[model samples]
Every structure is written in structure tokens, then in C-alpha cells.
Target: MARDPYRLIGRIQQVAHSLRKKSDHLLIDSAGVTTAQAGILSVIAGDPGCSQRDIARRLRLGESAVVAAIGRLRGAGLVERRVSDQDPRAVALFLTARGRETIGRAQETYGVLNGLVLDALGVGGRARFAELLDALDSAVASFPDRPDEAGPPGPD
Candidate 1:
């Protein structure tokens, strides 16, 4: 019989909460960015000039939610938008210098949180978990489409 995949899915939410809590604690004491903002910045940092639609797709976020995030980031001078050269109708997003600095700090906080999670798992456990996750990911990719996401998760 197949194991309950929902348990793994449910555990992921718990892990997300733990990471968010740790990120919040670090930001309050060491930095000044929220975890959600950090995630947005991280995605922007990786793919500069990506559209808000791309970000929403990458993050599995709603369009309105991504727009709100972009607004906050723009207000903070952490992100900037430019009209696409090829298509005047589209806007591309990039991180400002301040945004890069924030992302740097966020990376540190992320490293700490990652260390906590991986350390708890140990090296062997981490390897096995990664292998299982990869296999599951491959299995899911065989499907025609992931109706839940805007598009397939892609090579994340």
C-alpha cells in the first residue's frame, strides 16, 4: 500500500512555520525584514527582470498577493520595475541596491534555519530525504500538468 503522502505534505507546512518563526526572530534581533519579504527578495535576486507573473508562478502565490508584495518592496526602495523593451505592455522587476543588502541578510538567516533543519536530520538522513524527494518530484513531473500551480513547478 502507498504511504500517506498527506503526512509529508502536512509536515512541510510545519517546517515552513518553523523556518518563518526563526526568520522572524533573526530579523527582529539582527535584521529588519519579514520572512515573506525575504522570500520575495530571494526570488527576485535569482531572476532579475522577471515579471510579477513569473514571480507569482514561481512562488505559487496569487497575482494579488504578488502585487501587494511588489508594492511593499517598491515602497521600501528594495525593488524597481521597468517597462519591457520588447513588449511595452509588460513590466519587469529587479532588486535595488538596498534590496540586495536585505537579501544578503536574508541569506544569512536562511542559512541558520537551513542548518537547524539539516542538522536535525544528520548527513545520512539528509541524503536519503533528498533522494526520496527527487523521486517523488520525478513521479509528479510525469503528469500532464499540475492544475494546482499556475504552471508546473519547473526546475526549482
Candidate 2:
């Protein structure tokens, strides 16, 4: 018998929601930031001088959402924006000293969460699970109506 695909989708959503809730709590307690904010910070931390468009694209978020997050981060002195050298019309994002510190704490929190997930999956299972997730993502990307259909999904 064919398995119900919707059941798998629902399970995926449930697991994601649970993990997001836990991550939000850990992030709030560790860095006084929301998971969304932490995600933007982490991306900026990894790619200094990246544009807001870059962040939005990489995070699969809307431009306005990324703009708002950047506004909050700037207000909190966790992020700084500078004129982009590549595009004068665009702005580049950088993590401030405090932002780096906050990101360090956020990384620790994520590490704990990662450990929990890996422990649950076991060492060998972790690798296989990651492969499965990648395959799923690729399959979804292959759908004809996908917005960004230029090519297949790249490695995470």
C-alpha cells in the first residue's frame, strides 16, 4: 500500500515546531534574542559584510522581514550596517562586538540542542538522517512550480 505523504509532512512540521519552540526558549535564556534574530545573527556572523538581500535569500525569508530583524539588531547594537562597496545602493551587514559575544552564546545553546538530537539519533543514524533530509529537500526543489527553479538544492 502507498504511504500517505501528508502524514509524513505533518510529522515533519510537528517536529520542526517542537524544535523551534525549544530553540526559542534556549535562545531567549542565553542571548535575550528570538530564534529568528539568532538565525540572522549567525548568518551575518559567518558572512561578514553580506547584504540584507543576501541574508533574506540565504534564510529563505522575505526582504521586509530581514529588514525588520536587521533594524532590531541594529537598535540593540548587535549589528551594524555599512554602505556596500559592491553595490552603492545596497547595505552590508556586520556583527558588532556584542553581537559576536551573543552569537558565541547562541552557538553554545545550539550545540546543546544538536547534542540532544544526535544523542537521540545515535552516531550512525545522525549521518543517515541528514542524508534523508537532504534527499527530501532535493525532491521538493525539483517540483515544477518552485520559485527558485534554476537548479537543484545545494549541500547544506
Model 2 sits at a Cα RMSD from the real structure of 7.2
Candidate 2 clash total? Answer: 0
Candidate 2, residue 48: CA error in Å? 1.0
The Cα local distance difference test for each model comes to 0.85, 0.93
Candidate with maximal lDDT: 2
Q: What are the per-model C-alpha RMSD values against the true structure?
A: 7.7, 7.2
Model 1 pairs whose backbones collide: none
User: What is the Cα-based lDDT of residue 135 in candidate 1?
Assistant: 92
Supply the TM-score for candidate 1. Answer: 0.75
Tens digits of per-residue lDDT for model 1 on 18-77? 877877888656546787778788899999988989888888789899999899889999
| Per-residue lDDT of 83 in model 2 | 92
Model 2 lDDT on a 0 to 1 scale: 0.93
Point out where model 1 deviates above 4 Å.
1-12, 135-156
Tens digit of lDDT per residue, candidate 2, span 31-55?
Answer: 9888999999999999999988889
lDDT of 1: 0.85
- Find the candidate with the highest TM-score and give its number: 2
